[model samples]
Target: MSIAGLLIRRERLARAWSQEGLCRGICGTSYLSKIEQGKAAASEEVLALLFARLGLSWTDDADGALHAQTEACMEALFGGDAPAFAAAFARLRAQERTLLCSPCAADYLLLREFACEADGERRPLDAEFVSFLDQRQLALQRVLEGRHEEAALLYPAAAIRLWQGAHLYARGRYAAATEALRAAYDAAAAEGYAHIMMNCRVYLGNCCSDSGDPKRMQQHYAVAQRLAEALGDQKILSTIRYNDAATKIECGDFAAAYAYFSALEETDAMSLHKLAVCCEALGRRDEALTALARAEAMLPEGEAHAPERQMLALVRCRLETPDYLHDERYGTLLTDCFALLRRERGAGYARFHLKWMLKWYKANRRYREACALLEDFPAEK
Candidate 1:
C-alpha cells in the first residue's frame, strides 16, 4: 500500500473508527478500502477530502530538499550532537506545514518523537502508530526505555547491535559487551555509518576500562576521540574525556583525575558529581561536599533520578561520617546503597561504589558485611 494510505489506515484505526465511519458522506466504504489497500489510486480531491475528514493533511508534491534536510536532522540526532540536532530541528520546524503535507510526514513525526525524548520530554508513541513502525524504530524505542534485551531481539541491525553492546556493558558483562560492540563496529565501518562506529568505539573503550585493560581502553578512546572531532560532536568528545578521567580514578590517580574533572565544564549533574568524587578522594572534604550539594541541586524530583539521589546520599554519608564504621548512620546508608546497586542493570557506576564499600569493610575488619556484599553482587567470573 502507499505510505499515505498506510498512515491514514493506521491513524483511523488508532481512533477506533471503522472504514464506513471514516468514509461517511465522503466515499463508499469499498472505495475507501481500495485506497487503503492500494487497490485503486486516490485522486487529489478525494485524498484531500479524506484527510480533512480525518483531521490529517497530505500533498502529492514532494520536496527533495526537505527530504534531504530530514535525513540530516536524523543523522545529527543519532550522532548524539544535541546542539546540531536542535539547530536542524528548528529549521525543520520552520517548514512544518510543507513537511507534514509531503511524503516525509510519517518519518518526520517519528523523528520528532525521538527529538522529544532526547530533550527529556517524552511523548509516548501511540500503540497503533508504534505497531506501524519498522523494526529498527521499534528497537530504538525499546533501547530508549532501557528495555535493551527486547531491543536486541527486534532485529540484528547495526544500530540495534550497538545498543545491545552498550546494555551489556552496563550490566557488567564486559567480554560479551566487547564482542558485540566489535561486531557492531565492523558492520558500521563496512556500511560507512560513522556515528555508529564512533559510538561503538566509545562503548568498547568503556568495556576495556572496566575490564582492566587500560592501554586498550586508551586506544579505543583515541579512535573515538578522532571520530568525535571529525563529526564536530563536542558532547561525545566531552564524554570521552570524562570516561578517561574516570578510568584514572579507577587507577587511583586521584590527583590527575581531579585536575581533569576540574577543567571540564560542569554542564550536567553527573559532571558535578564526578568532580565531587575526585575532591573526596583528594582529602578536600569541604570542597567535595560543596560539589555534591551542587549536583544534588541540579537533579530533578522524580523516580528517574532515584539512582542519582541514592548515589549522592552515599557520598554525603562518606563525607559526613569519616568514622563510618563506628557510626550508626553508616549502616543505613550502606543498606540503601547496596539496595540501589542490586537494582542496577549496569555495573559501570555500581562497580565503583561496590569497590569503595568493600575496601571500607575490609579496612575496618567488617569481614561479615563484606562477605554478604560479595554474595549479593559476585564479581564477574
Candidate 2:
C-alpha cells in the first residue's frame, strides 16, 4: 500500500471516521477505499484536498526544493557535519508525511536510522524499512551487532570498506583491519570524504598500536588529529587523545600517560578503569583504589560485565595486597583473566597480559603454566 494511503487510513481510524465521512467532499467512498487498499492512486488535487480535510499538510515537492534538501541532508551526513545534518534532518522531519509518501522515502528512512545510531539509540527497523537498506547499510547493522564475519561478506565496495575494517578491528584482527582501513583511506582520499578519511586514519592508528608499531601509530594519529580538527569533531578528537594516552602506557611513560588520562573530562567506567591503571603504574595506590571503586560502582551487576569485572578484580588484588605475587587470590584472578581474555577473543589484550603473566610464572618457577599459556595463545603474525 502507498504510505500516504496507509497513513490516511490510520489517521481516519484514529479519529473514528468512516470512509464515507473522510471522502464525503473529496471523492466517492469506493474510490477512497480503492486508494486506501493500494488498488488506485489519488490525484494530487484529491490528495491535497483529503489531507486538508483531515487537518494534515500535503506537499508534493512541486518545486523540487524538498528533493534538494534531501540530498543536502545526505551530503552533511557523509561530510561529518553533525550540526549541519541535525538542522537539515529537522527540516526534513517537519515534512515527514510528505517525505514518507515521496519517491525518496527509502533515503529518508536510511538517514533516520543513521541519525538514530549517531545518537546512541537502538531500535528495531520496520520490515519495510529494512527491505530498503542496501548492502552497505545492512553490513553496518551487522557490524553494530558485533557480527564482524557476516558484515565482512557484505562489504564489497571500496566506499564501505571502512565498516569492514571497523568490524575486523572489533574482532581483534589487527592485520586484516589495517589492510582494509588503508584501502578505505585511499578511497576516501580520492573521493574527498574528510570524515571517512579521518575515521580510517583513527582505525589504522589503533591497528598499528595493537601491533606494537608506535611510529606508524603516531603518524596515523597525526593525520587523524588534523582531519578531526578541520572537521571540528570533538568526539573523534577525544577518541584520538584517549588512544594516544594508551600508547604512552605501552611505551612505559606512566607519568605522561597518567597526566593525559587524568585530564580527560570523561568519567565513564572504561575511562575510570584506565585512570586506575595509570594511578597504579605511578604508585598512587590510594588514588588508584578510589578510581577503581568509582569504576566498579558504575558497572551494573550482570554477566554482561563478567569479563570487565574479572579484569578489575585483578587490578584490585594487586592494589590491596603488599605481597600480591605470593597471594593465592592473585593467582586465581590471573587465571580467570586469561580464561576470559581467551573467551572474548581479544588477542591484543591477551598479548599484553601474557607478557606479565609469563614474567610472573618464570619468577615463581612455574615453567609448566607458562608453557601452557603460550600454547593456548600463540603470538600473532
Candidate 3:
C-alpha cells in the first residue's frame, strides 16, 4: 500500500470515521484515490491543510491501532497474502470478544472479505470459509432469542456482538457501538474479504451518524465507498451510495441529499427506496411517488407483492398516513408481506419489520393476521 492509503486510513481511524462519513465531506473521493496510489503527491501547503483538518500523519513511524491497521490494510492494497493478515487479526480479535462463537466465527468474516476481493482468489479456502459463516449464523439465532443480559457474558460471540452493536447504534449508544464495530472491523479487515470488510465499514459509519459524529461518519464512508469502488461490484457500490445519501440527509444537506437520492433512481432497490425517501424528504412527494411507481411497474406481477414492493407501500403509507393504526389494513398486509418475505427473501431474516408484525399482532388484537402469518410462513428454518 502507498502513503495515500496509509494516510487516509490513518486519518479515518483517528476520527473513528467510516466511508459514508467521508462521502459527506467536500473532499469527495478523487483526492482519496490519488492519496492511496501515492500519485497526488500533495505539496507542503496541502499536507499542512490536511493536518489542520484531519490531524497529524504517520510519516512512516506512527504507532497505535491506526498505524498497525494501516500496515495490515496496506498489505491488502498490493494484493499480497491476505489470509495471513486476516488469520492473524482474527486471533487477536477472538481474544477480546466477551461473547463470541470462537475464532472460527472471526475467521469467517475475514474469509468473506478475501472472497470479495479479486486479489484473494482461492476456492478451497472459500468453501471452508463459507461453512464457518453458515455455522456462525446458526449460533446467532440462539443469541437473538436469548436474553441480552445473559449474552454479554458469552465468549467470542462475534455475530451476536455485532448485532447488539447495531442495536445500540440505532438506539443512540455511540461509545459502546463504536467499540463493538471497531473490534469486528479490526478482525474482519485483516481477512481482506471485500463484502464483509465494506459492510463493517458501512455499519460503523451508520453508528457515527446516529451519534451525530459527522467527521467520523465521513471518514468511514470514504473508506467504504473507496473499497466498494475498488471491488467494482455494482450491487455493493450502490448500497454504499444509498447509505452515504442517508447520512447526508441526517446532516441536513437537503440539496446534496437530493442529488444523492436522485442517483439511486438509476441503480437498484436500495437506491430506489433511498431515492424515494430523499424525494419525500425534500417535499418532492410527487417525485418520490413516481419513482416508486416506476419501480413497481418494472417488477413482474408475481414479485409485485414482494418485500421490496411492500416496503415501498409502507413508505407510501408514511406519506399518506403516518400512523400505523390509521391504515388499519396495513397491519394485516405487513404481516402477510413479511411472512412472504421470510419464505422468499433468504437474507430477510433479522430484518427490522420482521418482528414488528409479530410483536404488534401479539400485543394488539391482530391475532387473526398473526395466525395467518404463522400458517402462511413457509415451514423452514
Candidate 4:
C-alpha cells in the first residue's frame, strides 16, 4: 500500500474507527476501502476532508497548523534554539495531552524527553510512554521485516532510534548508542533522509570517540564533516569542528586541537571549557585561565551549576595553584564535581573526570585520598 494509505489506516485504527465511520459523510465504504488498500487514489480535496473529519491533516503545508508547528518546534530543537524549543515543547505537551492519538505523538514525546535532558531536568520515563513507543517500534520492525513497499511509513523508526541512541550516549553506554545510531543511519541513508542521516553520523562519530577506536572515530567524523560541508550547513559544520577538536584532545593532538577550538565563535560553557583544555595543552596558561573564568561567569548557581561548569572550576584551580589538590576548597570542589558527573553527566564523562582526579591526586602524592577515592568509586566495572 502507499505510505499515505498506511497512515490513514493506522490513524483510523488508532481512533478505533471503521471504514464506515470514516466514510460516513466523505465517500462510500467501497471507495474508502480502495483508497486504504491503495487500489485507488483519493483526490486532494477528498483526502483533506477525510483527514479533517478524523482530526488529522493529510498535508504538511503551512496551512496545516499542527504539522507546521510540530515541524517548526523540531527544527528549533535540532538547531539548539532554547527559547524556540521550550515554546514548541509546551505546545506539543498540550496537544498530546489533549489527543493521545495525535499523529506525531511519539515524535513530540521523544523531542520533549531530549529537551528535558538538555535542560538538566531529566525526568524518569512514564510507563505509558514507554509502552506506546515500544508498540511503534514493534510495528516499524514488522514493516521492515516484511520489506513493504510503504517502508517509508516506518520513517519514524529512524527518529526513535536516534533518541534511543542519545539516551544511551548520555548514560555512557557508548557501544549501545553506536548500535542505535548506526541503525538509524542505515535506515535514514536508505531513504535519502539527509538531515536525519547527518545527525546520526555526527552522533555515531561521538560514540566512536568514547569507544576508543580512533580510526573509526575519525572516519565517522570525516563522513559527517563531508556531508555537512556538502550541504553548506554552517551550524553542523561548526558542530563537527567542535567534536573533532574534542576527539583530537583524546588522541593527544593538542596543537591541532587548540587551533580547532580557538577558531570557533561560540563562547558558551561547553566551548569555553573545551577550549581551556586546548589552551592548557599548548601551555597558554593565561588563555586557559581566561577561558575558564569566562565559562564560570556564564554559569548560574545552585541546581543550575552544571557538571561541566564544575569541571571548568577544577581545571582553573589546577592551572592557577600548585597546592590546589591539598586545599580543602579545591578538594571539595573536585568531590562535588565527581558527584555531579556520576549523578547527571553520564558514564563516559564521569569516568573521564574521575581518571583526571585520580591522576592529579596520585601525582601530588596525595596517596591516602587517592586510595580512598578508588575505594569509594571503583573504576573496574
Query: How close is every model to the real structure, measured as TM-score?
Result: 0.80, 0.71, 0.40, 0.61
RMSD of each: 3.9, 5.3, 21.1, 9.7
Q: Per-residue lDDT of 1-381 in model 3, one digit per residue for the tens?
A: 133344454556669976446534435567755654455665444444454455443232233443354335334422332455566455445433311222222333343443344421422332222222334333433333433323434433443455555555544455676677676566556655455556667778766655557688779888888887887656656666666666676566767878876754366654566567668768888888887887677666664336677767766775676565545677666666665655554322223354456666776777897787655333221
Predicted candidate 4 versus true structure: per-residue lDDT over 226-305, tens digit per residue = 87788776778788877777777767788988887788766688788878988877889999999888888888887656
| Cα lDDT of model 2 by residue, 43-112, tens digit | 8888888878888866777888877989999777755556788899998889777786664565676677
lDDT of each structure? Answer: 0.77, 0.76, 0.54, 0.69
Itemize residue pairs with steric clashes in candidate 4: none
Worst 10 residues of 3 by lDDT: 97-106
RMSD of 3: 21.1
Q: Considering every candidate listed, which one attains the maximal TM-score? A: 1
Residue 115's lDDT within candidate 4 is 66
**Tens-digit lDDT track of model 1 for 221-285:** 99999999998878799889889988888888889889987786555777777778889888899
Ten residues in a row with the worst lDDT in model 2?
A: 119-128
Worst 10 residues of 4 by lDDT: 143-152
User: Which has the greatest lDDT?
Assistant: 1
Task: Give the Cα-based TM-score of candidate 4 against the true structure.
Answer: 0.61
Predicted structure 3, TM vs. truth: 0.40
